[model samples]
Target: MRFSVPLAALLGAGLSEAQYLISEMSFGYAGRISSADNPGVIPNFVVSGQPTKPEILSSKVILTPVAPGNARGAIWSEQPLKHPNFIVDVDFRASGPDRAGGNFNIWLANHGKDIGAKSVYSAGRFEGLVLVVDSHGGQGGMLRGFLNDGSVDYSQHHSVDQLAFGHCQYSYRNLGRPSQIKMRQTSTSFRVQIDGKTCFETDRVSLPTGYDVGVTASTPDNPDSFEIFKLVVMSDTSSHDASSNSGDNNNNNNNNNNNNNNNNGNSNNGNSNGGSNMLYKKQSSSGDESFVDLADEEADVFQTSKSQFQDLHNRLQGTNHQLSSVYRSVSRHHQMDEQRHNEIKDLLAALQSKVELLDEISSFRQRIVALENEVRNMNNELHKKLQDNERSVQGALRVHHNSLTQRVAESVPGHGKLIAVIIGTQVILVVGYVLYKRRRANSPKKYL
Candidate 1:
């Protein structure tokens, strides 16, 4: 568990963990592909970036579109890398229609056992780097790797979700338009940049080093061309200050921290043997010397994710408010309708009362007319009797007058009673009809 490792091995392993992998295809370095000696050919390439039969002029990588108008290319590493942290960067100039591929044309394949179309990615055996481009703008890029698996030895695979650590504008119009791209890895964070501008940064990425670095390019409708300017690799050693002679103290601290953390993490996995397949530590050690936006990247990622979450929360709140307003408005309208219905019922009652009054007045008028007619008839009978006989005419007149008066009196009372009954009946019928109508209107029945 406490075995010492050579300085060189430690450096290589550490370099894999701390280096920044940058690729700027700007036709620089004699248009030679990064890490490849050939001018146009991309090494470890599953797909060709340039034509198999290329046209090289003045060290420029010229590409001529084939039929159907799409160009595809890829470049992979000759050997696998085994570091736990690192960065990657790539730049390309694209023209015509550019469509993203199933997998990122720009990616880091880690712990990949074989190279071909069909390859099995073992648990904890792979990590991916991605940059997606479309006509709209740059899409978010991602890095993926696994932790544990069941088939190998563990009970289950601790699957990781696709986290958006960084985003860069990868549009067809922006490619090769004087841009610098970079991916940097530190002890506990990852940073990405484009054109010296920080794009993606995250502290959640935990990947092992010794991954095959590769580039794959694809365009769908039209042939896409990329211009690569430079590819540089460097290690991260910012933790150390060469001016200070406290190298001994730094070395001791670095070793102790590295060993302690590794052992503790392993022991928690139910494996008693902590240093058998553990990481090697060395004397006179130093951290990786890779360069990236360390401070800015961490801050940037935190802000971006925070902003996105806030935006979604605001939208939800707005929607709830809108729904609440609609409900309140509907409730108010319903109450108003109920009040109007009540007013209509009161008006109908008043109308029925007035109708009953008019009927009573009509009956009273008819009775008065009948009484007048009886009085006139009695006077005419008395006058006829007086003309027929002179003798006792006054007495006859008196009797006739009395008889008429009594008849008038009797008729008046009878007429009044009859009129009152008829008026009462009509009033009752009218009130009953109005009440029945109001009840029916309030019930759940069709108005028509």
Candidate 2:
């Protein structure tokens, strides 16, 4: 038993460091030996054949293995654990599975108390891992998590028609498995793994702490036979044991005494109204089923409301997504427009440059044409002036020669040479003026 509380003092000392408190501990298993040669510790308790008041039958737990190869068992406890965060390990060996009492091997319940007829609670459910194994046929085992409240958060179950086991095949199931199951009060998450394989995990658990923890088994109409090997429960002690259990025994004795007195009073009233009263009590007991039904109905309403809320939330999210897409599209369009504008600007700049070049070319061509016309006109004018000057020079020379012949007769014949020189000077002046005008007209417009 102490082994089940492994490192309790150490754990207490480490609580502050770990930020958790531990409270109660327990283990469960069926008392059975595989072979007389191999004597092992098995804990079992007897229960009535029928469900009278639905009580629990549990035996003293052994924390250690009985033999060298003896396997372990599963265990659980009522809240509050020693710490807010607690870990429970189950080392169990299951064999000769049968169908009885729903064939549920392991279960956990919280926040519950026994009413006169049936248990009642704000909320409580049996939850655990289901194994799928068949040694007889070749069927394998599966691990499932379920809730007694008809609520399923996580599950692992094999097909019902699957074979259990077959010849030449080892047990097609995970058995004699050692697993560490942990629950932290702060979080509703619980996880289980066998060996190194994850068997089950869930976060939908919302059971309250500081509540009764119990384990139960049933002999089903199917009558399945299975055994729990070992169990270990570690919880927050500071919280789980909020009240001092110092005088719990004394208090229980007192309560029992009071109950006896109440029973006596009930017996005295058991006269003519006894049968009628009993019928009324039965009817009231059936009302317990209605409690479950009411809970189910309320749960249905809550689920419907939740689904509607979720649907609306999803619609809003979709709208937001569409809006975001539209924003991005607009941004892209703006960017493209800017790029096109830049391209147009570049094209305009190039066109302007080409236009300036064309203008310059046109001016150059016009200058060339003007220069050619001016040169032709200057040549014609020069030729005409030359002919006129030649005529004038000839006339002057003839007059002067006649005057010089007269003078020579009277004075000297060399006077005629002077007249010829004057005529040549006039011709040279006219030619120079004509050549200057032609050069001015032929010059480039740029220079002008």
Give the alpha-carbon lDDT of every model: 0.46, 0.40
Q: How many residue pairs clash in each candidate?
A: 33, 49
lDDT (0-100) at residue 41 of candidate 2? 24
150 Cα displacement, candidate 2 (Å): 7.3
Q: Write candidate 2's Cα lDDT for 51-129 as tens digits.
A: 3312122433222222222222223343333343455545433333332112223334443222111111112222322
TM-score of each: 0.36, 0.29
- Give candidate 1 misplaced runs (Cα > 4 Å): 1-67, 82-87, 97-104, 111-126, 136-165, 168-178, 237-448
Stretches of candidate 2 above 4 Å error?
1-23, 28-84, 97-102, 111-139, 148-188, 218-225, 236-448
Residue 82 displacement in candidate 2 (angstroms): 8.4
RMSD of 2: 38.5
Error of model 1, residue 104, in angstroms: 6.3
